[model samples]
Target chain A: MRYIKNPMEIEKTSFEIIGREMGEHNFTEAQLQIVKRVIHTTADFQYKDLLEISEGAIEAGKEALRNSPLIYTDTNMILSGINKRALGTLKGNAICYVNLEEVHKEAKEKSITRSMAAVEKACDENVDIFVFGNAPTALFKLRELIKEGKAKPKLIIAVPVGFVGASESKEGLEELNIPYITVRGRKGGSTVAASIVNALMYMIVER
Target chain B: MRYIKNPMEIEKTSFEIIGREMGEHNFTEAQLQIVKRVIHTTADFQYKDLLEISEGAIEAGKEALRNSPLIYTDTNMILSGINKRALGTLKGNAICYVNLEEVHKEAKEKSITRSMAAVEKACDENVDIFVFGNAPTALFKLRELIKEGKAKPKLIIAVPVGFVGASESKEGLEELNIPYITVRGRKGGSTVAASIVNALMYMIVER
Candidate 1:
């Protein structure tokens, strides 16, 4: 499908009406795909219009987060890119990683061998913005951290476009009381989700 | 790609040199597609085979659970379905759903204007077994619940299979401190996860 170019107008008009902005929010490729794809595929002006509105809300979220301290979800890729891509963004924060083994405590033998409990560690440290490149479970469980008073990221940027695994993380985000952006209706992966959050974080923090 | 007709055999024999047993206690979907789909079209079998070994330990968990009660992670679709499909299998035990409003509290405004808190309540009150649907997050937050004194389910049937948005939870069943059953690689859903748990419970509770 062809991508929609320059969704700024739709993004803006949406904000003016319902206060859900997308134009201003920084978005990764997958997130952009959702917004653009949804607009392209929508037959109804209402749904199309809704996409515009969501975009605008995303934009507002971006604006709200402009120049904010940011931290990437410490997945393998993002964690690896830290020195290269996260130099400006990570600021003074330590690229967080969860020692599931350490956290697993007494149940060490029985539980999940997490690649790295990056999200949990981020929350435990109370980082400003917890970015999920595509760790849906991390995004999913963030709500719990927020609840237990462990992890509380201001804005959770998730792009669940063209993916199946972490795509449903929107539900988790909603559950966690975090603000997020999705293309229109699609699943997503870690790289794309990270890209979108990165875009927004760049707009907000670096811009 | 075609779905594996008899995944059990592949899981037990060919996938790995040594068959996997039930998972360790702690650690750690349905949808558009009828069967399981993955990020990479190929080689998922390899991953499945490894996860199966982890899940085979469910019997140990069953024994542990028989001695105590089961705790839930939060309110989720899989956990909610246990009452319906699983009622017949599970009996004579104190089954509780972890009241989880904290996870969904964040996305209150995005989902058809429903309250995340309400959904969490429904999920928390749903059932004992999470049904182990939903793609597990890499962070393995479920470990936190068990370790932090928030949750303590005895027999966990981890089927870390997401039909679309959900992952087959059984793969990470090892992350939890409970005895978990990681079924065949792709057999999972609201119905599938529930049935397996119910069947297991029946095997246990009936006799």
Candidate 2:
């Protein structure tokens, strides 16, 4: 197996894996189309293979989010990726995602680690943005990259989410000089971040 | 009141807020000692005032987490914090902390929001052995900082981070380089990250 470093390549590989998994689930045509778009975006583009992969992953992820809303919406599952959480935000108006539905201690094909795995994917793919939820080490690395001028994330949000609001994450964003909006402290959550990103994506892509 | 961006100040505020809101539950001397130790270890030790304030706030936070760990431990909460429906990792001895008493969201003294607010307490107070059961956003921000070289946390975890692991919050950490840990998927509301972190702290601190 090849070591796929680019976000796009990683996304493409992940899409294929997701496709395999979704294959048994019987997705709708629209869902299938979105999945295909994600796969194609990550797989087919040759000009900017890496960037395309990341974009496709985001799109695919977006579709996954929109298509499958969480039935119970457990916060632990959101934390662990047992289910999907949907939300809304003002910035970009895109319904971005953070794949908490697949998180687990073991790195499996059908796990949230795939989404976190996107960081290497983005880095290798040289994607435009490297949006992350709350992987402290990953964010630390991002900070390192920013300090070295080796990374370019238009927005880097480390919104401090507590039992109350999204202020700390907001502060992190402010420090990073990335334009971001959070749920104001306790209001922050995976769903909140997803909603914000999703809303942001909708704003940009829909526009 | 001066605007302090320090972690201690943030945590102190959280303690005061939670303590006041939660019928003013004061910390015992032993617990207060632990709080002080956490403050000195996690916080910068520079903001004496913030540290002083955070001591109270952190104790309040620990009290809250122990008493009601599930505030941030919901699938929706986890998803909202991590921004993904799934996560996977090979490490991160994570755990899920929840208040076994099952209080309604409205009747609860500590909401998931407030628990997350105390994250800065751990960081600001220089408290090394800190734990968060449901505060996904706080966890996310911490991860982001670590990834970006803003914070250098040694360990991060989620334990039943949500009710019954109803929604896992460790997905974000699964993707990063941090020494993360969590319980098995579907092992909802278990002491996965909490126990592990405590164990780790025991191992490291006792050394």
Candidate 1 CAPRI-style tier:
incorrect
By TM-score, the best candidate is 1
Write down the lDDT that model 2 would get.
0.34
Query: How far off is residue A180 in model 1, in Å?
Result: 1.3
Per-residue lDDT of A124 in model 1? 55
Residue A68 C-alpha lDDT in model 2: 26
The Cα RMSD in angstroms, rounded to one decimal, for candidate 2 relative to the true structure is 20.5
Question: On residues A18-94, what C-alpha lDDT tens digit does candidate 1 reach at each position?
Answer: 22332354545535544443322211122223222233445554554444454545344334323333345544342
Task: Mark the 10 consecutive residues where model 2 chain B has the least summed lDDT.
Answer: B83-92
Candidate 2, residue B139: Cα displacement in angstroms equals 28
The residue-by-residue lDDT of candidate 2 on A1-207, one tens digit each, is 112223334335544654554334343443344334322211211111111112134343444334422211112322333211223221111222233333333224533233333343344433333443333333444455566666654444342233222233233444554433332333223333333343334422432
Q: What is the lDDT of residue A127 in candidate 2?
A: 38
